[model samples]
Target chain A: MTKYLAVVSSKAEITALEEFAEQKLAKDDAIVLLSHPYAYGEQARLPGSVLKTSFDYLNREELVEIEGERFRLVPNWYKFDKEFEKSILYKGIQLGELPFGEVDVFFRENLRFLRGLSNAIRKENPDVVLTGKNSVAGSSVRAVAEKQQVKIIRYFELGKQRTFPLFPNLTTRKVSESKKKLSRILSELGRAKRGSKKTVFIASRGYLGNLEQELREKTGFNVFPLELFLLRQSINPLVAVKPFLNKKKLQGLFADAFNKYKQSTGFRENMVFDGVFIGDLFEFKLQQFALLNFPEFVSLVDRIDALFQKKKPCLLVVWSDFVPFEKICVLTAKKYRVPSIAIQHGIFPAPIYKKAGFIRAFAPLTADKTAVWGRAFKKILVDNGVEPGRIVVTGSPKLDSIYNRHFEPEKFKQQLGIGNKKLVVCATQPASSTNNPYQMVEQVLNVVERFPECFLVVKPHPVERTEKYEQLVQRANCNALVLQKTDLHALLNAASAVIIHSSTVGFEAILLERPVIILVRNQKRSGHTGKPRLF
Target chain B: MSSCLASVLQGKKLNELKKEMRKFSLERNICGDGKATERVIKFIENTAKKTGKIELKTK
Candidate 1:
């Protein structure tokens, strides 16, 4: 029986957790941590679990009821020793940790809430800890739990597939009973992509960064793709050997690699313990029975070789060098003597300033030639020991989309029903960076509230739906049109000004000739959070 | 120097800002010629020429 507690995100996850609790948890013997967005938290369906929250033992007056949501917000949530709080916040900053938006708001609630949760976990002293996400706030809680020597079980969902992996470390979490034909996976991606490529195999995780359309304009070749479930960090770890290849022979080849990986003494020597990916080498070593030697990589090599013989692409345009699949893509390309190129997808050349050398040191720069925005990005790659000849400055094609001039600003304004009002576009990125997008809208709403003639257009990041914000808008009683399924550039083109926390839209504003404000509310002093970074 | 100029120009009148922006654009050559993708394609094609065969027609 599992002795530890569980952290849940939503009501839907509550059902899954209840199932998990009933199946594995001891009766009347579990602690719970609910990182619920609303103030109400969960009360109805949770059995044999207790919420390890600030309110669990707090005075009722301390919790402020937030309107329009089932939850309350603690405005003065920094109930801990002030200096200790300061140091924890600074530790987050020193780690180059992204504080979703409003650092003060995030840290305060975390201090009040997670402190209670961590304390409860310490008191319970359970063997296993379960959670939904291992990002940001989850990262903080995991740090607290790691010291207690607790085993972690994470519940992850990829489309219709759900996985429960009791992990020893960050990586090595496998999806059981989920394996698809590599050909079928590739074909599904191609079908979803709908229009393009040169038999060129581009290993990507998310949307192809508009590269496929640009490649179509440049070259007529088909772009067959392979995207490992980068979101889950779980791929088909086993590759099926053909009818003839002796399994023992392949296993023999893998044993040496696995032993070398397992036997590595130093940080740089371990193949699996690379800084970019948090993987467990011990688990990898134990997988010899699953794959006949060389793990699934030998099979990847075989499948890719077959694909090359069939598709015959000129090169590979991989999406990100950060993901593990890029390593496989590069190795396969090297074997076939096919060129591999990685496009810098983000606004900035990665490795947040001080850690420029850290990216060079830790992350695997596997692409033969990195297609970057300009000389600056090319410089970063070359500094990182990538051959200077291999760095090509490919001015971002996504930015090139703005020049297409497809959407009329006036027409877009008319469509938004903001007739003659000066459009103040408030763009919010996905919740990964900012836990609450409502904060971004709140910031814009605050400023737009002052400007009587300004029409606020809340443009949400494509990944998360904005339907949830309708109620928040209704509560705030703000005249805001939360836009969905609209062209961002067209909206940006229409905007008299754009307000953002950290976002790439600032560059779009520059391209579209609009005023942009980067808001980082807290600075290195009195209030805690400082002026924000507008990318 | 560029950021300093932008910071100073932030709250200026629209016409004044536009004039300053026009001047800045003139001095810096910030305008695109719509040939970035073309240049990138050329670079890619040139790079691919080493290992892959391409059929280019005479213009």
Candidate 2:
């Protein structure tokens, strides 16, 4: 039996891929290793038997020890130690044993943990190592695979495609140069070996339901849903905690408590306990941390270096939204003689801040092949400096579901207890310094009052002040429902019409075959009332 | 910054803007030309071929 090692960044992605892998390969023979940035203890375990790797109690200590031999500990160990101490000490209890403060100790500890992972892979001596796209653990696996002379495969979940227009002010010259540089780099990486049984992983949910089998039939590359990753984390004991403590002090305290608890419980080194903690924190904050980690940067550089050293060609396919990371990937691809193809995540239009002139003019020229959602966005790319030849129109996969949806309005209305009445879905926009939701509510109420038979569904933007909406709903004294969940397809399907002020939901409503009215009331210009512009 | 200001100042009429936007609407053409997935796959394949690798079987 061919030995294969699958390293995953998150348990969610792991669980998602496990089902697909099980269908393709025997469960017993294939080994799956899950690496989380923080340890989640028993909570990280999968349903089936699988090996796990994570940061241990003395992760910093282990990293420090291994730093000199392998891996440069950027920002130094002292900074990490200070951060660790600060993270733990300020979290809850004012006084606890001060954790080891030496930067070298921390670096050695982390290095040891990484080595342990590499050693495990070496022992298994797997022919192929697979990981999710763009994660710390994924990057580490790539590094280990390179060192061990093992093949590396990455999985990515593609999302909806939309065409965005370019603001006219930005020029095409700058955009073309950037795209050319990226293209040049990707071309240098070379290509996969011909006739080799290439292991392919997809992270798209769209492919999971209806497209999986179709994709499999079409591509012959393994088509796995992103749900596998979700499953791993869902079953993990660490995933249950609600970590969104509003107070920073409380959050720190919880981290300290977690560390102490892990130590007492005899938690192993390099387990992703931090992930569990961070997962419980705000989603935005977690994303911010992931962006700052620089794992993607290191991994791209390392891969390019290896490719160059071996005189082998490689091609990297990446989503464009990871632009900052794309820069690193592009530069590394260039250095290592690799070719990269940037698939569009959504429509790229003229930069919103195009009023900033030259800054906007130079931004879109970064990708080799700029795959857009439609001709409009394509033109925007061309106007922004992308070579028209390099731009491809690949409609968004997310819209596939939208296009095929067939909703019975009466059935949905009955389910939601909405009687025979005209339904108006009032999708809220994000509240800005100049945009007041309260005033908009007043205007909407005024309109609703005129039509008693009409029911209003006031779905406020997730980040907006909920209390304000509640207060407005009360003030309006009209029958209303506020949508909390992100998916509003069902409600949209059942609506008679939709009202919003500069929201993407309006576009979604239009897709649902509903009339959309934009209501703009800028606080800066209170007296002005005009038909709002639809983008 | 001044250049950005100048462009905004040179704004087109609403009707003209709508005319420009007509090309993006569904009436003009289905954005994907009705074979988006296939197009994407082909692009990937061509890219792979250029890099000297056989296209991975999509199915």
Candidate 3:
């Protein structure tokens, strides 16, 4: 019998793969590797007996050996390359001098996912690996399949037609010289104006509410975009040479870790979820990633140093110190004795057992000062070990526009076409760093359908696509308007009650004095007793 | 999860919800009262003055 392994990460993938298996792989023995099973919610209906590749398998407390050192797997995955970092020195600056520590948090999850998939593939030993076309997961599959020497087929939907395309033959297009020149011209034009006005560098990825404009109008400080400054600076390859040459040290470190990993029975057995061990899977790729990014990091160091020396800014206002660029700016600002403030972007969650490390990323405020929304946030930060004196309860500058402007609730309701009905705004955020909003959106939709009196308005997170939620709304046949780009404050004004899944908008709803139902996934954290309580 | 939502939707526990949210907000001292922008501007002004980055343009 022919053996097949179907790698499905979402509901759409599972559905397409099932249809394909029924038509083509009906006679063949197939097993399904499901990740984010909550996305689609049906695993039993998949083509074969399902083997979950979801993070559900991760034992967060499990210990693993890397280079003869036993370390906790989940929290310290980024530290696997710690030794490599120690050996590198760029332009008389150490690796730790740059804001590179928290960057690994972004990649750690992907490494774990890739490691899990590699283990599953080795265990299954399928003839062909079938998966749906996903930019993030597909790259991982391509890499794993290429290494395993297995044939891989990707299921793609072009309009209505379902096409199964084979991998390993695609080639990339080169950037034209003229296009590069145009980009450089554009970058030069977009560079922030450096003038006599004392500047306050606003470190942001767009979306800073009214703070940017308000700062420009109300304050003497010129509001400069931190990102624009980074982009405007030309990269110097000479600064990167030291780290590039020291790439050998990284390879040696990974070799030591992998060799030690293979021999450790405790790690091989306990650190594994299914056959996947939370060990070094992408040793070569990670080394390359570090080597490539080190140059950029070194360049950023020089550029930030230039910013401090040239601009002589009074203060640096940033979104968060967790972001690499912002972190670098803040650290550099501190060296120059310039004060930096990190404005809280969202409502901080109360302490949770599993989310301790993740929550700590927000607390103890990375900048010289932290401006929070209220006393509640200050309390949370203080509880999380941040010095209270450094935190200023600045309220939310983003919400200032909402308070200042007038929003007609009836007009917003009319726009939504939910006439005279009580509007219940369901605000959603792309929960988790993995961007798993599907399951949360599905859960909200299911609950909203039961209440006929309430007219549901689904406001997706700014980063999320509206079409996906619209598709979900269409499939459910529910009477809910999925507004991707709408004034959330207006919607909150129209809402009789707000339903939220740990989104900052829920806090806004509270500020507007609208009743809020916080839909927390953790039953214990939701403070559930016999009686129903809105937490 | 849906159970609490059901209670809120049914209008059976809205007062309870509002009360809980109010208590939560009060304890945390949430809400900027529309003065957040003014405060942030003031902070910037004070910082600039303290640092003597630029001479104040007195109106």
Candidate 4:
């Protein structure tokens, strides 16, 4: 009578679980696969056997059903807000009191999934837990399983057959063996086109239209986008021939990287900003994540190094120093004596957390130059021990996109089905600041409710999972526009009033000259309808 | 965020902090036009020339 708690964080794992549900395991071998209830409801194919109940029991008052689905509702602002405060405020005595940014914010989001998983683990009391591939959900499940003293079986797909390991780690043998085989098909090493132009390697998708054009014109450098952006995407078709690279050299580099992991002291030894006790905890977690990811990191660095060796690029420009790929690329570029530059991708790392010591904010270590939004942003780096000379103000290349393009408010209003109504744009972060996602959405809804003539336009953060918000909209049946993959700057420009928690979007609203309101946990606005002030 | 950040997020009583940010932007307005990118290019080219290692095109 084996009880199994299975979790699906991958599409492959989802298909595998669906197949498993069809099979009759030995008697009393009941399985419960816990996932985000709303995640599977409309999008994924999930069976009732997965989880009998849902965490969404929110609205008893004025329930609105959408497409035959009723959303449980609650006022979530305070609860979610408190949860956020707890996760970030643990930084230190002085800096801990202030709000967190970037890496700390990611941990706060992971804490939500961790909470859900911990509850599921305790209630089900399963003998074992199963999940797939590397993701925030997978990491959260692993953390919970370790605390619960439960065994976790991880399955990774390899072409047709799958490798199921009780304690799964992405090891060198599994990685190298695949690349060695890839060398058979891809036999030629990728050659860089050596033009009279100085080459500069870029690691992020060129999202901004004019920035690259301007850089090439001013710098006289051939802007080369990195070949592999992630697991599958190719930034350049030519870089795809990297698989044909000398397998022996890649294997050798990976072996060295693995050895370094075994001998190396964790980030704890290197990082000075994080204060005592929790710093120790962060080091252990981040070190583990880094080690588990070492082989892949080594492979990427080696691949990029191959390009650097051939092309002899003068500069390497990456999105940020935080991401593992970008980190490796920066280090690799340094090894080749190529100056690496990190452009501000999102909000300039907020001043509050950078000075306080957010862990992954390690761009200063490798980047010769760190481009920022303005002098205030430069101060964030300099105050945190980054060299004053290294920080450069680039304003945001992303914002320059807004300056170049324009959207008609009338067209947007018609497209959104809110004809001639004043649009109160309520922007959301990709991750919730609080435990409850709906509470934040509902708070904005409550504001929109005030103006019967004005409908709410919910703009999602770029990195957000909008399913939770989508579910809330369906259940509440609010007259809100959830704009995904739309021109956000135009909407903000056209907005009557803008509402946001502390985020880069809020700053953008201010830059756009829109009336702004900064929502927080405990606050008193004696009168709700006064003119909006700059946040 | 510095101590003044608390004041800014509060949205009011942070006039000094806002002024500081505004002043910072004005002083560092090299981001205007193509000045920031020009600085980056000039810096990279000068370093390359100083090294006398790489032949860079600085048109």
Looking at model 2 chain A, report the run of 10 residues with the lowest lDDT sum: A91-100
Candidate 1 residue runs with Cα over 4 Å from true position: A1-198, A202-211, A217-306, A324-328, A349-352, A356-364, A383-386, A404-407, A430-437, A446-452, A465-471, A525-534, B1-31, B53-59
Instruction: Quote the lDDT for A390 in model 4.
Output: 80
Residue A92 lDDT (model 2): 23
As a TM-score, model 2 comes out at: 0.43
List candidate 4 segments past 4 Å from native.
A1-195, A206-209, A217-219, A227-292, A349-365, A401-407, A415-417, A431-438, A523-535, B1-59
Error of 1 at A75 (Å): 37
Identify the candidate with maximal DockQ: 3
What DockQ does each listed candidate score? Answer: 0.15, 0.10, 0.32, 0.11
On the 0 to 100 scale, the lDDT of residue A42 in model 4 is 33
Model 4, CA-based lDDT: 0.51
> How many Å off is the CA of A330 in candidate 3?
1.3
Per-model TM-score of chain A alone? 0.51, 0.42, 0.65, 0.56
Predicted candidate 4 versus true structure: per-residue lDDT over A1-535, tens digit per residue: 7777776544566666666656745655777766642233332344445552223221212111210110000111112233332332211211121112333443343333445566677777877676654543455565555566666555434134233331232245434533543343233113232354566677654444345545555555566656332422232234434443543454454445333433344422422111111232233333333333333344455565556667777777776755556666666666656777777765534333343433234434457887776776676567777888887666667666454566687887787788987777777754432223345666667655555667777777766667767766666645775776677777877776677764667666665555565565322211122323222
DockQ of 3: 0.32
Output the better candidate (1/3) by TM-score: 3
Candidate 3 Cα deviation (angstroms), residue A13: 7.1
Task: For model 4, give the interface RMSD.
Answer: 8.8
Instruction: State candidate 4's DockQ.
Output: 0.11
